[model samples]
Target: MLSLTDVDKVYLTENEAVQAVSSINLTVENGEFVSFIGPSGCGKTTVLSLIAGLFNPTSGKILMDNKEITGPTEKTGYMLQEDYLFPWLTIQKNIELGLIITNLYNEQTKKDAMTLLSDLGLDDKANAFPSELSGGMRQRAALVRMLAPKPSLLLLDEPFSALDYQTKLKLEDLVFSTLKQQNKTAILVTHDLSEAIAMSDRIFLFSSRPGTIYRVFDVPAEFKDKLPLEVRNDPNFHLFFQTVWKELEKVENQNSNTS
Candidate 1:
């Protein structure tokens, strides 16, 4: 569980302070999957960094469970647009990176890593270096590395952005299913409206730079049984997409006029 109360983030330099996020209030339930979708430089990723305690908010507070998040903790796992896997490392070693960091590696930790790769259909490639893997495979390996720590929360920052459309869809399905199976809470920051709709139980729309919470949309249950790609063809999908698109456009236009 996580809560952000009127959170604001400002970056200070020698010259001036730049506000990146403003007036954000949000609560994500345990085991929930949420996404933030908005225009570029709108602070979606900044908000995520706040949650991970990568950056402290300039004002207000971010709480995990009942306590404030001061800095990075084992409770969170972060996956970025770049896989960030070390090319020299084999897939298995890369997957073990998280465990090794926490000094929690053991027979069982090794076993868990092995079983996770096996379940993800990457068992045979465990000995292969990152350079030997395809883009999708490397990303999958990255996900496995993040999941290895057994974090209660997962922060996804455009995790599939660099992949081809077909590969992106497959990874979306895999990641969603894996998160559900692992019962991990997630907050995703994505530019893609459909990706947000297909993956999130709730979607938060943010405004332009110095981002503010523009609106929040709850994904309908009609497509609950469908995967991301399958949900795409569902009639409700297009309808909901249109509604979300309008809200985004409206906010963008408002931002444009004021600027």
Candidate 2:
């Protein structure tokens, strides 16, 4: 339901201009999970911000459904690396914060928020403050807060990177299942090759700074219906990883040659 065409972003300083993203064209179909993977400073997050209208592009346009996105649209929800929960507010209150800000407060909104919290297994923790919850719980709460608004699109920026490996794996499954259940269209920015392959229906591999789509691949069958662990165990998993790794290497090598 989201489309970006020939998008470009440039950051200017006194001495030089840094092109963070270049000619990025992408389309996310309804209910599709698409992940953008690249090395650090490759503008993955920049792409997310552009889609969210946190910043306008230097060139080209972004559209959701058919309307051009001018600024942050209510039809989209964003989750970042940090949970960013208010320390003082309880889980329930935190989730309610979005509803209140959007003026969506009402009986139905509250009921939906509570139902989301319960589904994420945070029903009892609803009364607990952010300080009292574990990292995973906090992340789950953060996601609940974002999804409670029922936005048409979800933007996730390394949402699982802060957790330990085991927790990350579990949360990946949790997030994957949750999104599938909610039937939400999502675009995820991540550096982890395995994580991207495990959760995404399609993966976009981006080049380094002045990021552009270097390659795109449809995830294999092993990952289509299986858990993250199962996907990792598949023999072709390493092959796919190596393939993406080499594509990234080519970008670095080409940049070096030009420099």
Among these predictions, the greatest TM-score belongs to: 1
lDDT of 2: 0.88
Where model 2 places Cα greater than 4 Å from the true spot, the runs are 256-259
Model 1, 1-259: lDDT tens per residue?
A: 8999999999889999889999999999999999999888889999999999997998999999999999988789999998999988899988887899967788897899889988988999999999998999999999989988789999999999999999999999999999988888999999999999998899999997788889999899876546788888887889999999999999888888988
Candidate 1 lands at a TM-score of 0.97
What TM-score fits each model?
A: 0.97, 0.95
**Candidate 2, 134-243: lDDT as tens digits:** 99999999999998788889999999999999989999989988888888999999888889888888999887767888888888766777766778888888998887
Model 1, residue pairs in steric clash: none
